[model samples]
Structure formats: C-alpha cells, structure tokens
Target: MHAGRDASDTLAALLADWQRARTPYRADAHDELAAVLVLAGSNADVERLNLAARAIRRQAGELTGPDRLYRLPGGRTLALAVGDHVRIRTNDYRARKSKGARADVLNGYRGTVVAIEADRSVIVQWRRPGADGPALATEKVSAVYIAVGGLSHGTAMTVAAAQGLTADRMLVYGMGLDPHTPYAAMTRDRLSAHLYLPRNVLESDADRARHSAPRNGAEELHRALNAYAAILQGDRADQLISPEPEPIAAVRARQREAAEQAEVQKMAQAVFAAAMLETVTDPRRPHGLLGDDQLQERISAAAAQTTALAKVVEVEQRRERQQAEQVTAVRAQVHAELAGERDRLATALTALDDAAHRHDAAQDRLRTAQRKVTALEATLHERYGGRIRGWLPSGERARLTEQLQQAKEKLTCAARRAEAAGRAEQAALRQAVEVFPAAPSAAELHQRLRVLANPRTFASALEKESAARVEAVLPGLADQRRVRAARMASPGLGDSAADRQHRARQALAALTAEADYRHRLDATRQRGEERARRDPAAPALARSRHEQAQQQAETRRRAREQQRGYRPSTPPGITAEGPRQGYGR
Candidate 1:
C-alpha cells in the first residue's frame, strides 16, 4: 500500500520499478491497451495528457477512424477518437432525448467513443452509472447535445473523477491538494499507485518564487513541508470530544436507537397516514372532509365578500380625507401661533437693544469723566515737580480735590443711569420670555390631536375588524370551554348555548380592555408626532458693563504710574477710590 511513504518516495520507487521492468512509453508498448491509468489534479493537465494519449494511439495506426472536436467544460476543445475514454458530464440525455440510451449514459458514466456519425454526433459504448463493469450500452448521442460542455476527454481523468476507475497500475500527478484526494487517487489501483511530487517543495508553494528567497533550501523544505502537510490534512482530528472511547456495547446501543428512530419515522409516514385514516363523519360530502358545495349559497357568499371589500376600500378613503383635513387645520394653527410668538419676541428684543445702547453710552461718559480727573492730577504733579506734599500750594491741592469730588459725583449719576438701563433691559428680557417662551417640544405640548394609522385589525373597518377580533378571541374561549368541560365531565353540560353566550361576553370584555389599552398607546405616539414646533429666537443684550469698568480701572492705574514717575503724585485716596468706587460698585 506504500504505507508510511510520501508521494516523492513513491515516485522514486516508481522510477526504480520502471527501470527494473525496462518497459518504455512507446506507441507499440500499449498495443493491447496497457492496464494503466493516468490521473491529474486539474482540467488543463487532463486535457494535455488526453491529447498526448490520443496522438500516441494515432501514431501507432490503431485508431484509423475519423474524429470530431468538441468543447469541454473549461473552454477547452477535445477530439473524441475511437477507443478513446469519455465521461458523460450531465444527466440531460435521460430527460427526454433518449429512452433506453438515456438510462445508460447518466452523469459520471465512463464510455468509449465507438463511432463518429456524419452529423458529428457520436455513438458511445457507455458503462453503467457507478459501475466498474465494461461498457453495457452503445448509444448514439446527438451532435447538438454533444456541443454542450457535457463531454470531456476521459483518457487522462482528474483524480476527482478517477474514483470509479481501477487498473493494474495508476500514475497520479499534481494531486497533493488534500490527504483525502491523494489517498483516494493512490488507492484506485489493483497493483501499484505511483504519485509524483517535487523534491524541492518550493515548486508546491504557489506565488512564493516572486516574494520569497530561501536562506537554506533544506530549512525551507523542512518548514514548507509542515505547511503543505497541513493543507493536505486539514484540522487534525485525533481526539474525540467525549475524551473517553465509546464501548462497543454503547456504540451498538446508539446505532440501535438511530435505527429505531428511523423505523418510527417510517411508521409515521407510511403506515399511519393512509387514505383510510382520512375518513370524515359524512361519506356523502364531496372530497369527504371538505363540505358539499351549494350553488346559490356559494354565489351569495362571494357577493357578500365583494361588498365587504368595497366597504373597506371606501372606509379607508374617507379616513384618509379626514386625516388630511385635521392635519391641515393643526398645521395652520401651528403657523399662526409661531408667527405671533416670533413677532412678540422681535419687539421685546428691539427694546432690549435700545436699553443696551443707553447703558453703553452711560459707561462711555463715566470713562470720559474719570480720564479728565486723571489729566488734572497729572497737570498738578507736573506744575509742582519735586515739591514735598506739605510745600505744595493748598489752593492747587484744594482745586484738585474739588475736581476729583465733582468727577465722583458725575460718575454716581452715570452709575444711576446705567443701573436704570440694566433694569429696563432685564424687564424687556422677562417680557420676551413670557411672550415667546421656548418652542414646544413633544413632551411639553398639550397634545390632544392624534394622527395614527392603526392596523387593519383595529382600524376604520369596524365590522371587518370585529371578524378578526372574534377569530382571535374564539381560541381563548375554546380553551376556557375545554377547561369547563374537563371540570364538568358530563354529557355537554359545560358547552350549553347560554354558557357559550356567557363565555363569549367575558371574552368580549377582556378584548375591549385590551383594545382600549392599544388605542391609548397608539394615540400617545401619534400625538407626539403631531406636536412639532419651529425654533424660537433667543437674542441676548450686553447687560453686564463690568468689562468696561475693569478697563477703565486699568487705564487709571497706568495714568497714576506716569504721574508717580514725574514728582509727588496726587493723593491716593482721591485718585484711586473716589471716582472709581462710585461707578465700579
């Protein structure tokens, strides 16, 4: 079996065996059709090998009959010669084209091309499907059907297609795809299965030649062999999920259970479900279970159904019209409210703007007054340069002091004006908030309107909707009736007409509560959708004048620093706090 040896080892052994036998691949060597099979991994290799086989036979003058070229599955052309192997690729021949021939030339059936007809249709001696026996039927396949990509050159079949083939010797190439593929390929021979794989192993590594250079051929082969082996044998499955080996008795018991389940299924389908089992109470009824048809009654039923459908369509149209009218009214109200609020907000904002202007003007005047006081202080200091505080003129000091007090008074008046303007701005802002308010979010709006498209079961067609409700409610009623029947256990005492009416009323009450709850949920969602509003205006006035106050204070501090650089500056009490604190406060 070539056990414990790889394809390369087998190939080397094959070469040694061939040399020992001294048999060559000459045209005369296979005169009696040598008992050998050539297999490949791909269609391209198969096509090439098949053509070589055909040419060898032709050179030997064995196949003298004319041949016809036909297309193979993978866009390759194959010439079918007498005594050449061919495999049927489809079951279409059995589908209406041929009768007795159809049954024989099934898919995967290997055959020999016996004759080529004038119309290019070929007569093939076909083997029975899945059989290893010799060809049992000779069928004339249509040229039109043969033109289909269904006929392939089978002289050199792929390892995938060599499953049904068995010969004295088999030579397989380029089929190291998986362990199963090579295993299946190698095991198809009665005598020897020779596999040929490259020794370098780099040849097996697809696209590796472009990107990779092996540091050491031996090392690369060693590494690449492991990966190649993995590709050949995916997911090593040596260990069982149970971790314990199943006993023979347990295995038999599990198989027995499976068999028993199969038998039970067979009984369920085959034995229990006969036509006799489908008997109805009345044998006179048409189709037994299906009740007898009444001519006038059936026609009336159809007419009534059509009228109901017409009513439902009318109801849907009226509902759409009413919803449109309601939406139009609500949208008009929303626009009107939006316009009124926007106008009020604009008026209030304009007032706030005016107040802000007045506040800014008052601040400017206070700053000017403070600057004048600083100038007077600077002039006094310059006029009396290098003078001691006691030597300075009392008249000039009194004059500077009076001017500082006057400036402080003016600042106080400006501060009062600013404070009044701030009050006015605040009043305007409050009025704006009261008039415009914030826009209506879904949560805040008083949503009394609902715009819902309920399901057909609970919508405008009340009568039709009731049919569905009854259908739903009856099952529950039946369950209750069944429970009562079980409790009573009498001859139909629990299922009387009055009792049925009572039970139906209880079901109706429950349905009414549930329907009401659903309506409330739908209404809530619909109202939320209906409560849309436009964005509101939020214009803010520049109310706080503290930034200007800080600037003025900094300006005054710089002025005092300049005055100090010259001579005795004015008194700190009058320059720093007298006018500044009056307005800054």
Candidate 2:
C-alpha cells in the first residue's frame, strides 16, 4: 500500500509537470480566467495565485472568449465562455427485482456531462421496460446530454445505479464513497432524514452495502479514464501548492523619498552658491568710513527723522480723521436741511400749481362767457332781422322790431345831415348808415353798432371825441342810442325831458372820448354814486370791487407759477467721488 501511494504521488507530480508544459489552446480564454482570478483575489497575492491555478484548470477549453453557445432545457440559448459550468440532463431507464417482489421500472433520471455533445440530442439507451423482462435492448434515444465524446455506453447507467444505495452501504462498498458528499448535501440542506434509517428495521445498510460495489467492464474503465484525466488536468489539485511574492510598495516609497531629498539638497546648494556670489560682488566695502560709522550715523538720523515724520503723520492722520468726521456730520446736517427744503419746496410748488390751474380755469370761464355773449348777440340779431325774425318767439320779436325801427329813423336823420355837409362826408355817412338799416329788432341794431365800432379804432376815436371833432360825431350819435337803451332798461326812472336829454348827452360823452370806454363807464357810474351819497341825485356803480379783487388774485397766481423753480434729484452716474466704487472694494 505504501509503494502504491508513492507511485500515485509520482504520477500526480508528473501529470502536473506535463500540464504546465502543454501549449495553450485559446489565448483569450487564458487571459479572461487570469483577469477573473486577479479581480477575485485583490487583497492577497498568494490567494490570487491559488485562484489563478484553479481558474486555469476549471476554465480550460478549445473555444475562446464567449463564442460558444449552449441550449438549456427551457429552450433558451446562452452564449458561453471557456470557464462557464452548465448542467446537462439525460433520461435513464432501468429494471430491477427484489426477492418475492414484482420487478419495477425507473425512467428519465439526470447526470452531468464530461464533454460536449456529439449529436443533435443525447442518445439515451433503455436497459429494460417491463417488470418481468430480461435485460432490455440498447435503443438510442434523443435527450439533452447526447452521446458526448468522453463518456462510454454503460458509464451513464453506473452513475444512475449509485443513487439507489443507502448511506452505510455507499460508505462500505461504493467505488468512491466520499464522506464530503453527505457534508455537502447537509450544507446545501438537501440530505433527507428518511435516507438515514436504522439497520435492524429495514436491512437498508446491508442492501446498500451490496449495491455499492464497484461496477465491472466498460463502466469501471470509463470512470478510471475520467479520474486520470482530472488528475492530469490538475482539476482536483490541493489548494496550498503555490504561493505569491509580497508587493513592492515599500521599496517604491523609499525611492520616491530619496529622490525628493536629493532635489531639496540641490536647491539648498544653489541658494548657498547664489548667496556667496552676491557677497563677493557687493559694491560697499565692509570696513569703509561710509560703510560702518557713517552708515550707523545715517541709520540713527533716519530713525530720528522717522520718529519725527511718524509724529507729523500721526497728527495729520488725526486731523484728517477729525475732518472726515466733521465732514460726515456736516453732510448729515446738509442732507437733513436739503431734505426739508425739498419737501417744503415740493409742497409750495404743488400749491402754486393748484393756484395756476385755478387761474387758468377762471380765464377759461371768462372766455367762455364772452363767447356765449357773442353767440347770444348773433342769435338775437337773427331773431330781430326783418326776414329772420320769423325764427324768434312772437313776443320778443315784436318788441325788438319796434326798437330797431326807432334806431333806423335816428340813423337816417343823422345820415341826411352828414350828406348836406359834402359828398365825401355823405359817402362815409352812407357807409355807416348801411350798417344800421332798419334791423328786424333792437338786438339786431345793437349787433350792427358793435360791428361798426371797430375795437382797433379806440385810440383815434377817443382823441377826436375829446376835442369835439366832427369825426367823433358819428360815434357820439351811436353812443346816444346805447344811452337810450340803458334808460329804457331801468324800471323806476321818471325824469323831465331836459333831465333825460342831459343824461343821454352824458352817456354819449362817456362813450366817444374814453380810450377804455367800458372801464370808464363803470368808473363814472361808481363816482356818480359816490357823489350821489352826498347829493342824492346820481346813478349807482356798474361793477363791484369783489369782482375786481378776484380778477387781480387770479392774475398774480398765474405769474407766480410761470416763475416757479423745481428740479429733480441727481442720477447715479454723475457724483462727487466718481463711479470708482462700482469697480473696486
């Protein structure tokens, strides 16, 4: 037994040496398995070497990379790499008999393949089909395992026969009774308690012992060859056979530190050389009068000057700080004062604007009133005119027509006198008379008279009337007609013919000679009332002092607004210190 063991050891060593010396079939398969083991054992180099050996034995194949394909039982095809292990199954039928019991048939069992398929399907041959039959005919059947290259005819049947034995029988009589198989089954939780029965109750141990004996003929031969092949390939070799060397990180670190130290020493030498060169080339002699004593004296003087300059600078800085504070305080006060002034001015400006608006509104109202008066005069003229009188109310039309007829008679008598003077005078008189024909009513006559008295001729008419010239006579005659209109409008006046004539003459004089006749008329009436306060014999004023005061206030408000002063605040761009803050700190 010892010699046989030595021979087996020698054979294993030779096989390992031969496997190591063999040429690789696929370079890509070698690389892939090397990479997988290297990654799987990153922590320890020794573990990596062991893993590499296992990967080489486990993954050796004729095909490279993942080029090979394997079809699984579920009808799905998968791309396979050299090291990929897969399960293959084939059906096996067997016939067996027990003493005084009917024979039984088993069918379609499972097994692992040793090599690739030789045909489209694994050829499964049945041993027997009936309870009482002899050994069955060897008929090849199609299945997943096929009749692969390395397996023999009866080798598959022998593996199937091993599944019938009890645990003790398998241990005593099996060709390879691996105790690790039960441990492995237990580790995987697949060992059933029923398979481990007591020896006396069922003779299970004896039966298994008889059944576990090694097979004869081709089955034994095929298993021997498979075992020999596995040993040659180093597939089941011991794990602690190879070891790896330690990493070189510490040596690399020392080399890097030494290089850094050398660089630092070189830099130090260059600095020392530069210092020695500077010392030799320096212009100032160390022992010269200007070098030691004079330099010391200069340094002392410089120190004293620095002290004095520092004091001066300190004083200037203090002054500047005080000035800055004062400037800040003044700026704050100025800002407050400016703010107050701005607010006050804004309020005053608002008030001024309101007053100006009120003044404009009052002027607009006065203009509107004048326009309304002009339109009323035009309407009255149309109502009083002979043909256009049809547009007016019957009562007002009759009254206006009577007044117009009287005014036309007076104008005709004045025109005839002017005609007796001369042809040129008559022509002028006739032209004036044409403006004063027999108007349809009194309002029409008043409109014609207003048109004839051109507002632009105020100065010339006043000059002529003051001198009692003949040119003013025509204007004076129109004035007398207006005086009669006023007297007729008054409700409670009963005077003698001479008094009425005198009042009429006074009104004509007021109209012809005054430059601002309307203003003079108002003033004269006021003066007459004042006089009548003492004499009780004159008319009252035409306009009130309240109306005059309101007009004067409105005019003053408009003038103030025109002279108003207001300015908006300064924008961001143009300031005292420029726009430097936008760029710098």
Candidate 3:
C-alpha cells in the first residue's frame, strides 16, 4: 500500500497509483518514514539503479547545501546535510561528543543529521521516548582518519549493508539474480514490496535444454516468468539443504549403526509385545476358529503374564492423576496471583503517570526560578561587586524600586482624591454659607464619570451642557474609574502598601508582555504566510531546535490558569552570592 501497488491491467492505471503512493516523498527522502530500496544483483546493477533513482529524484528539485561529501565504505559518496538520515556503520566512542554529552553512536544506530558542523563531522539526533522531546540526544561524530567510517548512506544500501535495516517499501531488481541474498533484502519492508525482473528467455543451449522452448511470444514470456519464479522459489537460503554429499563409506557406517540400534530395540521389546498381542487376540469369532474351551485355555496361557506390567500401568496412571491435580492447583494459584498482580500493576502505572506529571511541572518551575535567580544575581553583580562598594544588593534595590513605583502611584491617586474631596468640602461649606442646589446623587455622579471616560461618544451633549453651565452642579468631575476605586483603592492604593506594589508590578509585567506579544504576533503572521507559500519538504521531520509541542503545552497550561483567574506569587529569593534562606533572608 505504501508503494501504491494495486491490481491494474493498464500501464496508465499502474502509474497513477504510484503517483498517489509517492505523493509526499522528499528529494532528500528525509520526509519519508522509510527509504526507497532499489535492490539489484551486482555492484554494477546497484549503481545503475541508483542512477535511475537519482535522476527521478532530482526532477523534484535537489536540496542545496555546502558541497560537503563523505565517501562511504564501498565507493559511495554521500553528501551530508541537515535533515539527511544516517546510520552508524562503525562503533565510535573515541570521537569527541557534541556539548560534552556522550551518545551511543554505535554500529546500527540510526539518527538524522540535525546539523552538519563540518565536512568530517555532523550532529546527529537520536529519538527520545515521548512526543514531547522527539529528538533529544545528539552526538558529534567525526572522522578519525580519512572518511567518517561511522557515518554511512541510509537512503540506499546493498544487501550486505542492509543486514539489520528496515524500511517502508522496497523495489527489487532481480536481473541476473539469485534469490539467496534477496531473502534478507525482500523481507526488510514492513509495508509494501515489489519485484521487477528482466525476463530470461531460454535462448542459450544450456537453458533451452533445461527448460522448454516457447512457440509464441506469450509462451516465451510465460516460460521465462515460470523459470524465474522457480529460481526464486528454489534458492531460498533457509530451505537450501546442501550438506556436503555423504561419502559412501560414511553412509554405509551410519546405515549399519541405525540397523543395529533398530535390532536391539526390537529384541528388547519382543517378548512383552508378543505376550500383549496374544492376550488381546480372540480366535473364536469365525465358525472354523478354535472352540470356547480351547480359546479360554489359550487365553489363560497368554494371560499368565506377570502382575508387574499391571503394577506399572497402575503406578503411571496414579502418578499422572496426581500430576494433573497439582497442575490444576498451580493454575488456580497462578490465576489468583496474576489477578492481584495485574491490579497492583495498574495502580502503579496510574501513580507513575501522576508522578511524571508532577515531575514535569516541578522541572518547569525549577527552570523559571533558575532564570529569575540568574537575572537577579546579574543585576546584583552589576550594582554591587563587593560588600564595601555599592549601597544595595539586587534584592534590596528591586524592593526599593518597587516601593518607589507604588509610592508614586499612591501619591498621584491620593492627590487626585484629595483635590476632588477638597473641592467637595469647599462646595459643601459654600452651600452652608450661601444658598445652593441639592448635591448630585451617586447615579448622577456615575453617569457624569461615564461621559468623561468616553467624551467623544457624548462630546456634543457634554459640551453643550458645559456651555450652558449645567456641568457646575458638583465641584469637579471625579476620575473616570469606578467611584470606590477612584476615591479609595485606586491603581497603587490597595489594602496594604505591599499589595499595591505587587498589583503595580503585575500590571507593568502584563503591559510589557502584551506589547511583546503584539510584536511577535505580527512577525508570526508574516512567517506563517511565507511558510504557506513554501514547498512542502521535511517540515514533518525538521522541526525547530526545540519541540513546539512542549511550548504549546506550556502555553495551554498558562492559558487555563489565566482563565481561572489564578495569579502567581513572587518566586523565592536569590542573591549575587547564592540562594539564601527564605526564613531569615
């Protein structure tokens, strides 16, 4: 199915099916789950097949990169680039690892060239256990001598080279071929396979003598195909039963030994077998057979067998019954124990999943905390290199800065409220002294504030009121914020100074994040549009340096928290020196 093989009579139908099957193949073949195999018989045939495949692949636009090529073992020059798959042909722990992390880039290990650092060395990534970090392990393998013998071509390989390899689909070229080697080559595909053989007609004398000469073209093809099929069916590596032809003397010796063994067994069991046969035989069934008394006498004489055989049978049957009971008991015990074990295992798996989730969350928090600590330490070092030099440690400076911002906000809110209150008090005092209209109601105040907040929408009406002096009822309009927040707990004026400072910091951070998000959104839009226009290649395999799925999960978790109105508390403390005790620091 992967090769789009279907029952078709016409060439067009066959080609159409192949087109669909080969829809999403890459020029580099990196996007393919498995490499296309062009199996051939000889080295020259292999080269020819490779040439044909290369010609067809290049029509799809070859991937361009720095002209760096490595000659593999067998004169195959493979060009290494990002996204090309490779398998380790040799065990190479002697080579230096990338980023000081050792990976088992041993023989038969498969990986993709995530990065080509140099002509001799490339960074290969091994798959991780989960979807979260698919490509987790990397190793930098380089040539110790001439070519990097560890790195080899993975897209196409010879039968000897493909010993332990597996693939998705295979194309077999069985011309001038023996089926012996192809046994290993053909079964490598897990999905689909095909065999293309050059028809071998019985034109030569030896072949014509062995096989029939066809009378017609169809008959010729039929004979050739039948011969090829017989060749394939007959030369199976496993079914080949060729021990060296036995020497005549050795064969005679074996035959004599087998005859002697048979004679010994026959002699050993002769008496008992004869007695048993005689005891079971009845000769009185036919009219001319022996009479009842004679038959009884003969039977009695035969039945004069020892009781030892009866004892042996009884003992064996008893032992078998006992063994059967024991087996039944054991089976019941095993079933009971297995049920309990399965329950325990299920419980353990559930607990393991929960533990894994908790571990992941803790790791994320640890990373966030570490980043914050690093930033704080950097600021501290920048401010105060030593104890005697600077006035504040990083934590102390941040605390003071936060306090200052809160203080300024509180001052502004208080001033606005005091001004508004003073104006109100003065108006009240003037009202007591002189005749004045009743004070405006709370609803009236709210309406006025709402108008002031969006003056454009009610601009003409408010302006007309102002022109007519109708706005002079109350002293000055309170701030457009809610009446309680405006007069009492405004931006930085909260239940406590610390609370207000935290709110201010949260607001500032939110604003900063929003601005950054807006910039990134625009960039993301442009990138997405451009990417949509780009040709589909190895995007499925060559994801970003880090997995986007992990980031997406983190984003989703944060979004859920935001939807629930969950706010994070300040992270724990760190200083330029190191982390300090939260109890005392």
Candidate 4:
C-alpha cells in the first residue's frame, strides 16, 4: 500500500510539471489547468484541483459549466467539477531563471490548494518525485501560497472573485520572485517610498512563520476576503453600480422638456386665435364681420346703386320699345300709300277698257264698209272689161273711167239688139191685124173656115180662101216657127229635129273647141294674177319663186303620174335609189 501511494504521488507531480511547462503564465492557463486536473488521482487533492482548474479555465474562456468536457494534449479527457487539484505557472518567478538554464524546475512538479484566495491565488503544497523512492513517493516537497496581478493576475482574479475567493499577497514557485504583490493592492505612494523587499525576505522561512503561524486563522481571513470580493465582483458582472440612478435622471429631464414644449404650443394657439378674431372684425372687406354703422352705410349704398341700375335698364328698354313702334308706324304708312296707288291704277284700267271697247266697235264698222267696196269693185270689173275704180285714187280713177266708157258702149249695143227684136214682133202683129181687119174673135174665124171647107170642095176652096184669113193664119204660123228656131239656137237646148240630124256630125268638134277656149282663158287669168303679185323684173326673188313653182309642178306631175297608174323604169346600173339620188334625180 505504501508503494502504491508513492507511485500515485509521483505520477501526479509529473503531470503537474508537464502542464506548467506547456502553458507558462501570460500563455493561456486553461490548457495547463485542464492537463493537471486530468492527471490528479481520485483523491481529495485531485477533487480540489479539478474545481480550481474549472474556475481558471472558465475565466480564460476554455472550460465552461459542469457539463463541459476537457481534452488533454495526449487525447485524455475528463469532466470538470468542484475541488479538483491543478497546477498553474507563477507569474513572479519567470524573471529569475538564466537564459540558458537547463534546470527543469517546472517538470515533474505539482501543487495543492490549502485554501482559495480572493485574488485567484492558491495556497499550494508542491511536490516532485524523489530519486530514492518509488514514483508515487514525494521526494521533493514544498508549500507556497500565490496571488496573480497585472493582465495575467487580473484574468485569474476576475475568475476567483466570481467564485468567492480573495488574496492580496501570493507565493509563487519558478517565478523571478517568490512572493508577488497584486498591482491593485500596491499604491504609487508605497512604490515611490521604495517600500520593496527581495523574494527571499518576503517569502523566507521567518516570514512564512510570521504569515502562517495559525493556519486556520489564515483560512478564516481568506473566507472573509472572499465574501467581500464576491459582492464587488457581482456588482461588476451585472453592471448595476452606476447605470440605475442615471437612467431615472434622464427620464425626468425628458419629461420636463416635453412639458415646456406643450406650454409653448398653447401660447402659439392663443396667438393664432387672436389673429383670426382680428381678421373677422375687419370691415373694409365684404366678407368680414361688419359693425352696425358700417352695415348701415353699405346697405344704403347698395340700395342707391340698385335704384340707379333699375332706372338705366328702364330707360334702355323704353328706347327699344319706341324704336319698334317707329318701325311699325313706317310700315303702316307705306302700306297706305301702296293701297292708294292700287286704287288709282284700278280706275285707269277701267277707263282703258271702255276706250278699247269703243275702238273695237269702230274697227268692226270700217271692216264692213271696206267689204262692201271690195264687192262693188269685183262686180264692176267683171261687167266692165275688168277695170272699174270709183273708189280708187285719181290716177287709177282715170283708167277706170275709160273702162266704164267701154262698158257703157257695150250696154248700148245690147240695147240696140233688144230694140230690133221688139220691132220684128210688132211688125208681125200689125200684119196679122191688117189681114184680119173684120176678124171675129180668133176662135170664130177658125170655125168659119172649118164650115166652109168640104172634102171635094176644100181642095177647090183652099185656093179661094180669103186673103185676110190666110194673112192672119200665116203670120201666127210664122211666129211659131221663129220661136222654134230661137229655141234651137239656145245652147242649153238641143237643135230642132232637122238641126239635130245635121248637128250630130259637128258635136264632138264643137265640144273640143269650147273646152280649149275655156282652158286658155283660165290659164291667161292665173298668169295675170301671178304676175301682179310677183314681179318678173326682180330676178333674184323671181328665181326663188320659180324654183318653188317648179317644186309644186313636180309634185303635181307626180300626182298625175300616180293617177295615171304610171311607174318609172329602174335606171341601168342602179340597184336602189339613195339620198344622193333623191337630190340629183
């Protein structure tokens, strides 16, 4: 059993020395603490080192909570808890070693915490394996209590303070000095007074006796210091010291400024209201509120203006009405004048109508007279050698007088012939009377002759008849022959039997002569009339008339040909007549 304990102790020391050498002070302590804690055996010392290592690792931002695992350089791992043994480098002892010193003071060395310090230092019992014993046996052993200062000490102190540990002075091995004072504890006054000591004096056997006389007393003192440091560290951690009171003061000042602004706004609103009231009370503008006097004055002015405008409108309207009336009056006057003119025109028209009727009557009478004169002239011309001019001008009247003289002579010759016929009739009547001087009524005379003559005696008596009777009978008989002869001479009657027998031979010849004479007379009269209407001396106009006559003659010839059933033969080499043929032929 003693051998086993010695082997365990030697192993713990070697592991601690390896940790310190690998991670010196000013280097990260977390790795060093972790290595030592894992190497420590399952003893009270190992348990305490593990806890202290955890705190140091946490402060160095390595090991965190109880659930976190620590990894060693050789791949060994362990969970951290409270009260685990650990090894850490001493910051004060690093300056004492020579540059080339080959001593392995850190190698194979380990420490134990007797008590925790407020400054994150540990009261450690260090041991290394001795050459004369088993590996677990503690060959070299020492006890030192240490505190850290400056950046290195500050980091460790910050963690120890959080864990309720306090320390002002510390003993460190392998540091240039055995005991190091925390910068927080040393003042400028002490340094200026040269209140300094060597590591031997400060951490000597005599000083250790003075400082460590009562071990429990030192422990109690550390506990008291830890309580105070815990309070201070808590205040720093929560940032509670200066921020709380200053926040309240800032809130109060902000509230005051807001109130002052509200007061200023209230004054501005009052000023605005006052200005609005002033505007409302003004009177020069029509929209503003008016005082009583101003209102009355405006009303009076408006009334006067309205009256003046109404008068002007009325005057303009009256002028327009007057103009319209004038136009109507002018139109009426013009219409009246036109009506008067129309009446005068009607009277004149009536007068003209009467005069026209009278003129027409006179014209009708003149036409009647002229027609009578024309009839007389025609009668005179026919009976008097075609020249009678009683109604003609003087020169024409002279020619007509000659014609009248010739007509008168013809009348005288007709009278002489009529007288000769009268004489012949009278002579015959007288001879009859003379021969029948004793003539009974003619019937009685005829009866006497019938009685006197007998058949045998009549032949003898016919010779002896009275001369008076023969004269009377012979004259009457002769007158009867003349009448018969005169009847034969009339054109309307046929010749007597003797004459008819003789005239039958001459009838056609006489009819031909008569027709020829009548035709010649009609032709001569037409020519005379045409010559009087159209003078042959006017050859230009005459040629036109001749052509017109030729056209008429041609029309008559064609009519005659049609009546005679005549048709012209087609000309040689002509198939049908064209328009050219109508003109040329």
Per-residue lDDT tens digits for candidate 2, residues 1-585, read 001112222222222322332224224332222112111111121222222232334323332343234443323233333333222233233233344243222232222122233443322223333568534332333333332312121211222233432221111111222333333222211122111111222223444365453355344334344443443355564447443233455565456545634543343333323222222222221211122234455545545555555566677568657655654555555445434443544444344444445555555555555555555556557766576555646877566556556555555554554444344433433333343345443345344444334444533434333334322323353354456566678634544344444544544343232323223434433343233333211111112333555688899999888757434344446467766323311
Cα lDDT of model 3 by residue, 1-585, tens digit:
111111111111222223334555653343353455444566444443333333223222242355367765534455565655566677766436545356555675555667666456777765534466445567777755227466654434556656666667666555446658767767988777665443332133466676554566565556555656677676423345556555865676567545644543333233222222222221211111233345455444434322334455567568657655654555555445434443444444344444445555555555555555556556656666677757544577777456555555555555555555555544443432222123143233334334444537445544454433322432322222244364365644434333444444454454444334334544533343234324243232224313555577789999998878854455557989988555411
The per-model lDDT (C-alpha) reads 0.52, 0.36, 0.47, 0.37
Evaluated against the true structure, the overall lDDT of model 4 is 0.37
Write down the TM-score for model 1: 0.30
True-structure RMSD, every candidate: 34.2, 49.7, 43.6, 70.7
TM-score of each: 0.30, 0.20, 0.30, 0.18
Q: Which window of ten consecutive residues has the lowest lDDT sum in model 4? A: 170-179
Candidate 1 per-residue lDDT over residues 228-316, each given as its tens digit: 46556664433355443557656765675456444433322221122112112112211222112332344345455545555665675
Q: Candidate 2 has which clashing residue pairs, if any? A: 122-146, 169-209, 384-440, 384-441, 400-441, 400-442
Ranking by lDDT: 1, 3, 4, 2
Q: Model 1, stretches more than 4 Å misplaced?
A: 1-35, 71-75, 92-103, 127-135, 199-585
Candidate with better lDDT, 1 vs 3: 1
Deviation from truth (RMSD, Å), model 1: 34.2
Residue 101 error, candidate 4, Å: 98
* Better model by lDDT: candidate 1 vs candidate 2: 1
